[model samples]
Target: LFSQVPLVEIDGIELTQTRAILSYLAAKYNLHGKDLKETFRIDMYADGTLDLMLMVALAVFKTPEEKEKSLALMVKKDKTQNFPIFEKILKEHGEDFLVGNKFSWADIQLLEAILMVEELDASVLSDFPLLKEFKTRINNIPTIKKFLHPGSHRKPPPDSHHVEYRF
Candidate 1:
């Protein structure tokens, strides 16, 4: 019933909202969580990661001068704020994944968010050693590794042409 750019259709059903689509896929793939509490934790982490992702998304639409400023601000906030929380979680949880010591949507979201920031600043995770390790660990997963291989479906960072197209 919904119509939008991110619409996803499967099994004769269509999901238009980003969250709805992600939730559906997460649930179907068994990445949501094992219980309510775990689901809440996964949602919390995924939402936080989305905040970072949004910043990167907005940066791409800015002029060169503004883009640099936006990216710098994004990196500053990520280093001083967002990255620390995730680093702490990895430290205290003593787990490879962010929630329940199992691979979940949260891990996938965080890895994607981290990579987006790294596109602007290669050393974005330098201060967060745990996050670096986490990225490496997640990147090595066979499925993810295959998806990340060159010529995969991954979209490159947005360029000036994207900004023009959006306007």
Candidate 2:
């Protein structure tokens, strides 16, 4: 979908951040919320979450001791805080999609977030039924489902073990 409408051709706009690209695509494709303020709020939250997840990934790549400390903190934050927030959002939205009951970029961002976190710590998902359900639900979407299948381009089972924490 994005490739068909490359960012370069969209008024010659350039976006340095993934979140910016997402926002631009959302607005361009009418996937954003009804109002600008709501769209801004959703984008801000999505970007913040992505930033935190990036930090967690960085920590996972650190030295052994640092990785242990980082992962411990991540486990705490993910379980006690982040996961619950996602659960609430999904429940509040009452739809598989994230914002305004549509298949918006926020949903894609969140699906990637869950997949990345699971890769880092497979056990991290065990306790979050909502998150697990959400992942399963998102993976069932037609476009996403095709990519999640065994022979698909975006399959997760293959590369997941490469970064398996030995701790």
Candidate 3:
């Protein structure tokens, strides 16, 4: 059933768990990295991206005032905690990609998270030079460039329909 998701059957198998689906695709596309060590690093970055996404997700359910507060917190955590971690990794690795010096799942995850935050606050990346460069680099990639264009399938930022102020 895929939990009401549109029919998605890969290799005749139905994957319900989020990580399982991502893992399968990453493995199939050779985005899991070269070896276990690389995979570990990629997974760490992927998890970090998920954490960033969760912060934004939490803000979607709050009232306007609460949403503002939550988003401020999200930006603060991102600027002070999340972005610095990735900045350090990119600076130290000195590579085009986050791990193994090659494009992988980690790079994709980070780029997606970066864009999502940028949508909320355009200046979210102002102080993160490497990440800013990283975004430009990733955005220039042929496939990603096309995918990011208007009229593409990329989901837009959360809107009124997606927000709910629960008691």
Candidate 4:
């Protein structure tokens, strides 16, 4: 509803995914990194986080047998393996935000990652203090803080319309 509503207009330039939308906005508004190469690196990390969250969401509502299988695989590859890779990038780029010191599309991607897993299991973040801190930091930002709370336009859609991955 948000994208096609009274105040929201859908542009003809079609981007297929959330990450693409973020990237397009960032580049258009100069919220991307210092240059093209840095922008690509930032996007790569953001996309990786998106992929990980998608896997976790799949595991959350699967049937018992399927859930168990998905959980085992994700715990190994998604959390244990893939998470640390992002962690290292965040640490290496340890300026308050990902991809240079300015807030960029990467921050939005990371916020989505945290939100995706937070409802499933808070403990999923226990191993990554930086990730936890990153979420808190982003949410506290004046602009982002508005959306983090209820009643904001960016609040998640009602449950009925949201994607539920029951198996």
Q: In order, what lDDT does every prediction score?
A: 0.88, 0.69, 0.84, 0.69
What digit string (tens of lDDT, one per residue) describes model 4 on residues 33-145? 89888788778877877776667655545566886676566555645876677678779968788777778877887787767656555677789878778888888988788
Mark the regions of model 2 whose C-alpha exceeds 4 Å error after superposition.
Answer: 1-15, 150-167
Error of 4 at 51 (Å): 1.2
TM-score of each: 0.91, 0.69, 0.87, 0.71
lDDT of 1 at 4: 45
Model 1 CA deviation exceeding 4 Å by range: 1-3
lDDT of 1 at 136: 96
Q: Number of clashing pairs, model 1?
A: 0
Candidate 2 residue lDDT tens string, 1-167: 35322233357655545556766777887767777776776686577578757666566357778876876776677777887888887777677666766666667677777876777688877877777887888888897887777876763432224457332
TM-score, candidate 2, is 0.69
Residue pairs in steric clash, candidate 3? none
TM-score-based ranking, best first?
Answer: 1, 3, 4, 2
lDDT of the structure predicted as candidate 1: 0.88
Candidate 4 yields a Cα-based lDDT of 0.69
- Models sorted by lDDT, best on top: 1, 3, 2, 4
